[model samples]
Target: MEEKPFLGLRTVIYAAPDLSATKAWYAKALAIEPYFDEPFYVGFNVGGYELGLIPDASIVEGSTVSYWGVADIDKVIQRFLNLGASIHTDIQDVGDGIKTASIKDPFGNVVGLIENPHFSL
Candidate 1:
């Protein structure tokens, strides 16, 4: 039998105390509407990647980290900040010409961003 490479990221779920509010905020921030909505979960199709929001009464701060790909780290960081996301990790070169950063959205979810010159779709 031959081994197969793992499929790329498909979904990243974030806990939200107020699912409706969180969903609305994400819609505005991402400038896209959710394709899936339910009482328990809400999902947005972000360029084929899924951003999921689930109702969680016990949601905590910085519970999970999911990095999103970006063309320009600095510009994307500024855009996120402009959307009212606070810097959780400032942009920095990780190595191999890759840069990364993270931000805490208004709902306390950590949204990470990465810029890799070597990566391509």
Candidate 2:
């Protein structure tokens, strides 16, 4: 099956160091309240999806950066690669109109860039 290459950033999880600080930062910056209320997990309902912010000092190896989505997956990947973003994984067709590529930012955090072309991710 041909990979349905599209960009729909459905969901993302951020492993912040300080939960309170991260939550406050996002709430102030974006002006949105988190829908999912929990002591450990913070879920921010924004747009049509939710951004899960979990404070984990160890995630994908102490990395804390997650990408949302991009219109052109390859182009977006290229842009990051050109800017010295070491690609951890090449673009892979997972299935069901979902394509993903992961890269390690300069801060040692792996940020996955996704593009869902076929359906609304």
Candidate 3:
């Protein structure tokens, strides 16, 4: 077999203008505290994946959007909205029973969610 070039997504980092505020927001949103915290970065272990937040004052607009797998996209989207995330993209079936949605987090980062019947951990 050819060497597998792509393993999988390991970590997704978001720029945090206010590190403390962003860290607290994600902690409450994910319902899991960060495993690593410092003035430079904060890391959260989300279902074997890493979500990192880094302090940067000059971060630009439109950073990379990483979709987290979820069982129910609607429910998760609602929860995120309740937690003060604005909808960046409404829930929609992209194709083949895969649904995706995105939101602008309170800290101005795009948070995406996906529900794929074909994917399993």
Against the true structure, what is each candidate's TM-score? 0.85, 0.46, 0.91
Q: Which prediction has the highest TM-score against the true structure?
A: 3
Rank by lDDT (best first): 3, 1, 2
**Candidate 3 regions off by >4 Å?**
57-62
Instruction: Indicate whether candidate 2 or candidate 3 has the larger lDDT.
Output: 3
What global local distance difference test value does model 1 have? 0.85
Task: Give residue 80's error in model 1 in angstroms.
Answer: 1.9
lDDT of 1 at 104: 87
Give a tens-digit lDDT track for model 3, residues 3-45.
9999999998888989999999999999999999999889999
In candidate 3, how many Å is residue 13 off?
A: 0.3
Worst 10 residues of 3 by lDDT: 56-65
Candidate 2 lDDT over residue span 43-83, tens digit each: 98766777777767465354444655667888877766666
Model 1 TM-score is: 0.85
For model 1, what is the alpha-carbon lDDT of residue 83? Answer: 78
lDDT of 2 at 6: 69
lDDT, candidate 2, residue 117?
74
